[model samples]
Target chain A: MSNINFKNIKDRQFDAIVIGSGASGGWAAKEFAEKGLKTLVLERGRNVEHVKDYPTTNMYPYEFDHRLETTYTDKQINPIANSCYAYKEDSQHFFVKDHEHPYIQEKEFDWIRGYQVGGKSLLWARQTQRWSEYDFQGPERDGFAVDWPIRYDDIAPWYSYVERFVGISGNRDGLDTLPDGEFLPAFPLNPVEDHFRKSIQTKFKNRYIISARCAHLSKPEPIHIEQGRVQCQNRTLCQRGCPFGGYFSSNASTIPWALKTGNLTLRPHSVVHSIIYDDKAGKAIGVKVIDTESLEELDFFANVIFVNAATLNTNLILLNSKSNRFPNGLGNDNDLLGKYVAFHNYTARITAEYDGLLDYRTDGRNPAGGGYIPNFRNVRKQETDFLRGWAAGFGANRGNVQDRSGVGAELKTSLLDNSKWGNWNVHSHMMAETIPKEGNTVWLDAQKTDKWGVPLLHISIDYASDDWARRDDYYEQMTAMYEAAGFTNIKTSNDPRRPGNDIHEMGGVRMGHDVKTSLLNRWNQLHQCQNVYVTDGACMTSTGTQNPTLTYMALTARAVDHAVKSLKTGTI
Target chain B: MNGNRINRRAALRTMLYIAAGTMVLPACFRESGSKTIGLVNMTINEEQELLLAEVVETLIPSSQTPGAKELLLHLFVLKMVDDCHSPEDQRNFTEGLEGFAAMEDPATGTKFINLSPADRLRFLKQIGDQDNDKITMFYSMTKRRCIQGYMNSKNVMTDLKKYELIPGRYIADFKIG
Candidate 1:
């Protein structure tokens, strides 16, 4: 508490300025601070203290106003925000209401955001699957976007580095598509899930179903215990924020570590406007920020700046950074600052009832993560009609079937009967990869502006034709698999069909080998501005069918190491 | 009167009408009762509350276990409809409550609240099995709300659902089938 310097933010210069206190920003703060660099973390939202901020952590279902459902007024205010399953009565405080923060949706994009100090880290689904060699070398082989400068080998060590500190719970399934991570004890697969895994493995030669790799401390290591985080209680109400520090959140993990180092100066309500670029110096010197509360503009100088302000906001900041030398906005030499944006297609799903698995019933309560079937479509080659593949998440459970038709004592007896549990039912959703296109981009709306006087970002991204084709394939294959397993009442749906709802928005300021093609280089540094780095979702060259937070943490750690070495050599 | 004051008064009246309708008076203006009712900031009046209590009690009457009235599920139902349900649904609920209050037994023309237990049961069963959309909707909604309130009550959830705050372990297989 004493270490975090809240006062004198206008005076003291920092060694590094990290924008956005999220997954990548927290890592940037920790890595930079641990390396003896004076780091400044600017969070746009209000300050949310660790355990004190989790108000609904101990609340029961009955304690809520709507029994864990959002109010009608709240739903009306945040129609797009409340669409996500997490946007409910218990965790509504964590979400950014749509009325408060508005953006011009040129194509009706659901930009769900959490603007608190921890940002979306407090609201992220903690599925932590690592990308493999296939994911990194995707663009080069298929010829869609520019090639990723760093391969899987470059990031594997960093993945290990981040995974060791933040405990990942998963088994070492020897599959190259979804590479194994350094794991604690994996959560055990339930009887139905185990049966499905075996059946799937036996049926398909090239596929595997394993427990979803999640950033949960199943068995806390000594380092995790030293940080005061305990093992997961499997309560699964993590969107309320974990008081036990059982799951990996910036509020629980990295930001606290960074604060403990006495080198981090956290300034909440400081919304970054743009980067202050120096033409003669050929680098970025500082960032221009506006205080969210007072609406006062301020500048904080730093030797190096990391734009970890999520995917779209990172592009917004970079695109707004106008200078005399680079008039088209910062390092956007080929006008590629906010181009080739993509998101995971999350509309498609398959559900079925398995009457044979009645003997093998799963427990009612579960940790949020489900069994993950890695992308098996184009692992070796593009055998399918689609270009890329999709990852399917599997979950099976048993529920009570209360008799609703009858009234009186019979209905009460039917509901109260202990043996009224239904047969095992299984379901899975397709997180298909969308191709990054030149047309799908985000640019500043010339007409609209936010309350802070920044131009409202006009998002024009949607699912391409390949994404739709891939969805059909996902539905077909998944239904076939369920049928093979002797399941009945097979159902499939593609409702709420829209991009950006998956919340895995990626690739606006992408990395590439050539300076002409992309904004950022192989090291995630902007090509024109060497001192500036965009290592969040903005650095993704291709949208792989994996949960991207783990990859973002690894990339941020790797980029910070490169930046520190470059600083030592006086490269800037 | 101030414009804001008039608007606020109109809103409150509308809310009360939406909860109790013109047939019933507001709870605060009703006869002072000896029963210790926990006053919640909702539009449901005292008589309406008693009617709901009687109605829900008829649905799940006292046997070996506690009934809806014993669990005070009418209060839960009122709070839920007022705060949680949409304004459209709230209006529908209040209109339905008015209809329920106005309904009389076909045999003896006795008001719903004054009917004998068996006659009340038969009347409710007839209402529940009605072909008319309004009658069916009102009966279905009331039944569902009562069931939800009673089922989620502390006694029901703790005893039947066995909801634990912390399971401590992710056991793959449980003994219950």
Candidate 2:
């Protein structure tokens, strides 16, 4: 709480300014800095140093007081954050408190946000599946919002470029719908999972249940080793942050790499208010930032600005950037700045017991990444009742059953014996693609402002009939699969999950070939403002079934490349 | 300098108690408060500690491995009841302990604590199995906390459960014994 006088903001001018330090921002900063641009990364949260700041990384369950349960105060502070399984006592500090941060929810939107240097990158599930040609051509085929400006070939090499540095681990399952990527050795499936994989492969020609392609380094390459990352140790305590730099995080990988370049300047607790626009110049000159601690306003100039402040906030920032040239907001002339928002439907879960796997069990602690069944229903053509498809994350494991009843020596002996563990059980959850609509949007709340005086984002997004239809299909198909696999006690949960709970929210400032229909172009640059790139989740045109962070990274890197080239060519 | 400093371990312990459903009150508030002194505030005499320890030992006695008292599980129970449980739950548990102390063995005509280990076990078991509200509530609460503390103990988890912190590789398909 020390009050410090503001320095000259003009002195902090850079070639490029990236307003985030999460997945997208990290990559943008790295790419820009490596390309010899003096890049400034503005993170609106406290700096969390790698390994050192991961306080609970090496802690044992027995060492923890509540083992792994959230405190009453934790729930009281941020019930939304507590709703997420990752927001336990072990990693409560990483999540934002609901009381401290306020946003208007026209619909029930469980906006799970992390406010730190690494941001949600540290808290992400690390599932990195590539969007296929079918995904890129989805809107055109189905006649949805607007066609994506770019296709699979546009992002494929860039995906490879990021993957080489990040170190993705998976087997090359050469399926056309779910295209393979450059990978390290894949994690082997358990016997029950293997059985299911073989069964699915034999039964269906369309579906392929392969090991999930994740950011964890299964076998550290020279590039990963150079980044000081090692092989993942199957800890499954990734939410606490990886001390080994096992999985990719801004703190562990990209941000650090960017810093090592000597061309990157990281400014933490710099809450950006708006982009400063020059009407005559017809381009964004700089960004106005509010100091989170002292509430002092500072404006820094930059040649280029990459809006990688996650999805909703990116839209909020751009919508708030008003000027004489763009009264609505910067590059928001057509009122498409904060509309057509979408999030993955994670409401469906199917679970069943496999008594036949009594002889076998999954050994060692399984990490967050698991076996993935690529969407099979409507990959080639829209044959289903619904338009879009959903990807299923499948996992199988055995549970230890301690005797809760009885007492004395017998009970103690029973509990101590690992031989008396329970039978194997398999479970799968659906991550369905959400179709973006005009009604589902995020706009600035005119009434309320935060402590920093920035208007709060009013998010009004929900699932449509298509979402429900997908859930029904998910339940039906998964149940049948489990039944066919000779599993008993099969149960499918169709419990409704509120939007933003999946944390895969995208498409507020989406990219399209048409300038009126979208805010950003194919290269992720604003149509009117070439120097300003919005290459985070904000640039996503469609909410594909895959986890969006990897795509965001690739897009950020790709956008930086395009912007840098434009700067040299004098086009921007 | 110390005033601004936070004891992280103590803070973590407090959070654990809170998560376990125990509500610990501030030390400064003890003077102003009435009828809701936390277990952390209360000073249980040596005799009471010994009695609780003996009771836990009976509940989860040692075989070749360490018993409840050997692992100092009674301290965990005391801490949980004092720091974790709600005020109402604490009162119920306190009253239940008193009630348990009063119950006499028919054959020996001695109070529960005064009875032999074997007789005490039988009496406690019979009380535990009873449908009576007081006996059932007390037994279940005590047993649950006792077991939770014991099972999660460093020694137990390390030796018995064979908890590995760093399993270098995940052997997905292994034959279960």
Question: Highest DockQ: which candidate?
Answer: 2
Q: Which docking category, incorrect, acceptable, medium or high, applies to candidate 2?
A: acceptable
Lowest lDDT sum, 10 consecutive residues, model 1 chain A, at A1-10
- Report the Cα lDDT for residue A281, model 1: 85
Per-model TM-score, in order, reads: 0.93, 0.90
Query: What lDDT is reached at residue A3 by model 2?
Result: 31
How does candidate 2 fare on TM-score? 0.90
Interface RMSD value for candidate 1, one decimal?
A: 2.2
Cα lDDT tens digits, model 2, A544-566, are: 89988889999888889999999
Tens-place lDDT digits, model 1, residues A21-82: 99899999999999999899998998887899999999877666456767666777788888
Q: Per-prediction interface RMSD? A: 2.2, 2.1
